[model samples]
Target: MPEEMKTLVVTGLRTQFNTAKGPVAAVRDVNLKVARGEIVGLVGESGSGKSVTGLSIMGLIDAPGEITAGAILLNGEDLRKASPKRLRELRGDRIAMIFQDPMMTLNPVLRIDTQMIEAIRVHDHKVGRQEARERCRDALGLVGIPSPEERLEAYPHEFSGGMRQRVAIAIAMLNRPDIIIADEPTTALDVTIQSQILAQMQKLCRDTGTALIWITHDLTVVAGLTDRVYVMYAGDVVEEAPVEDLLDRPIHPYTDGLIRSIPSHNAPGQPLNQIPGITPALDRMPAGCRFHPRCPRRTDACLEEIALRSFGPAREARCIHPLVEG
Candidate 1:
């Protein structure tokens, strides 16, 4: 790797759920690399293992759902083999995750100041209470919270939905973690708030050189927020490329369908093109190419297992019949 490339490498990542029927492969043979200060978008439909992949990276997967095989490397260090104590030290200090639901990270019973102060103290125990309180207030200001001192004394429920989400984002930023895995942190907010939050996050990441993994089902969101995009389906990555390249010249059929499904480009009265068929259940994955059943350009060869191959400089696709310009 080059001096500028501080890569977070993930190879052969496989997460399986132990069910009564059999093992359910939620994520299979997934490989990805997020370099320093790079924002990588992981886009997929519901139950497509996007969130599971993020959780696995953060070492938050519970029993019954386990990362069966994989190497999660952060700046060349393998996090998978790290001890629980080491992982605990890393979480919220070196790696933080902002979930879709603000409540998931926020304690409803505690005031915002209490939660944020505790977070600051966890990483910087030598700081006095007043200093921690000031740091908490500054973190809140960084996320665009108005009247930070007053807001800190309020409960989580006191804030509006969008405000609560912003506060959650503020908490994630309190530690200035090197990597922040945001799993649709703005999905619940209105358009205005979403845009504001996205802008703030982008600016913060750029200024601080924080690598981000933003997982969402919205192509539009990814287009606006990420430097690159990775499309996943049936627990496998179907396409990966620069954001502009992936959006403008998507190689995989699934990627094309997703681009076409976005309603923003449709005419005043034209119906948006919607990709039919739900993602296959984990235990019921199709024989060869998991996406063949739903692909428009699928052929008999698509019924054979197709591994991801290089398509361009820093771009890859797993489709046998990838689209190419004549």
Candidate 2:
């Protein structure tokens, strides 16, 4: 067996945003890591801070939002303290992000070839347009897009939703980046399309040694695509474990709830189990255990803030009364 190269490591990362009332914590004390050729799933509901964590790592958090604590280390380099110039230099070349909507990455008017070629050239000026365009075509082909040459001359509007997303992914891989933060890139696609994309993504990362952090709310996706899983609730990670171990036995109540809510778990005509309450608002986050209000296993001990504690060598949970049994 060989050791995998660490590509991204996050420690105690806290990102907050300013609202009219006050600062709202979007990501709190998050720690995550991904090594070359590995896919890690960051799973949670919509307001669970998974996407914010991704944005923070990519240095894409806008005004009124900022990283207040912790470190985002890219192969031991701290991203929080990195300069604007340095961050820009790393963005497309070393690290790339595939946004939820392809439109967020693609220009409405520009040809696909124009956009992708420029993405490559901007990072390394030495790569000529012809060379970059060839790479762009190859990238598109790698993602299962057909007629790569003709597609390069097409505009974003010409493609279907799934195809557009495949293009966005192709551009992200243009530089053969060390890491990619994918923000629900397949959520809008049909399941058939989603599966195709997932297979291609897995193959791409394995072949190229790109580490991936897939931020999504879908448990089934995690089951199929990730090696490890992090379950977040109310801006904090409630559980972290190897995918098979976590799936076999979810330690945190929130994680258990999420697993139960997956569509596959429902009876043919029965309603699915829903988590009891909404994720607490950032400003209105509950004291002590953020998930206490909705957790079935919450106890008086949950009234005090619980630090993430390990259950086994590779498994950790934030709940004091963690569910250790299957």
- Candidate 2 total steric clashes: 0
Q: With candidate 2 superimposed using the best TM-score fit, by how many Å does residue 93's alpha carbon deviate from the native?
A: 1.0
- Residue runs of model 1 more than 4 Å from their true location after superposition: 1-4
CA lDDT of every candidate: 0.89, 0.90
Predicted candidate 2 versus true structure: per-residue lDDT over 1-326, tens digit per residue = 12224788888999999889989999999998788888999999879999999999999999899889998888778888999999998998899999889999999999999999889988899988889889999999999989999999999999999999999999899899999999999998898999999998999999999989999999889999999999998899989999998998989988888888887888977999998878777888888999999988777888898999888877899988878942
Instruction: Report, for all candidates in order, the number of backbone clashes.
Output: 0, 0
Please list all clashing residue pairs in model 1, or write none if there are none: none
Model 1 agreement with the true structure over 154-258: per-residue lDDT tens digits: 999999988898888888888888899999999888999999999999999998888999999999989888999889998998888999999999899889988
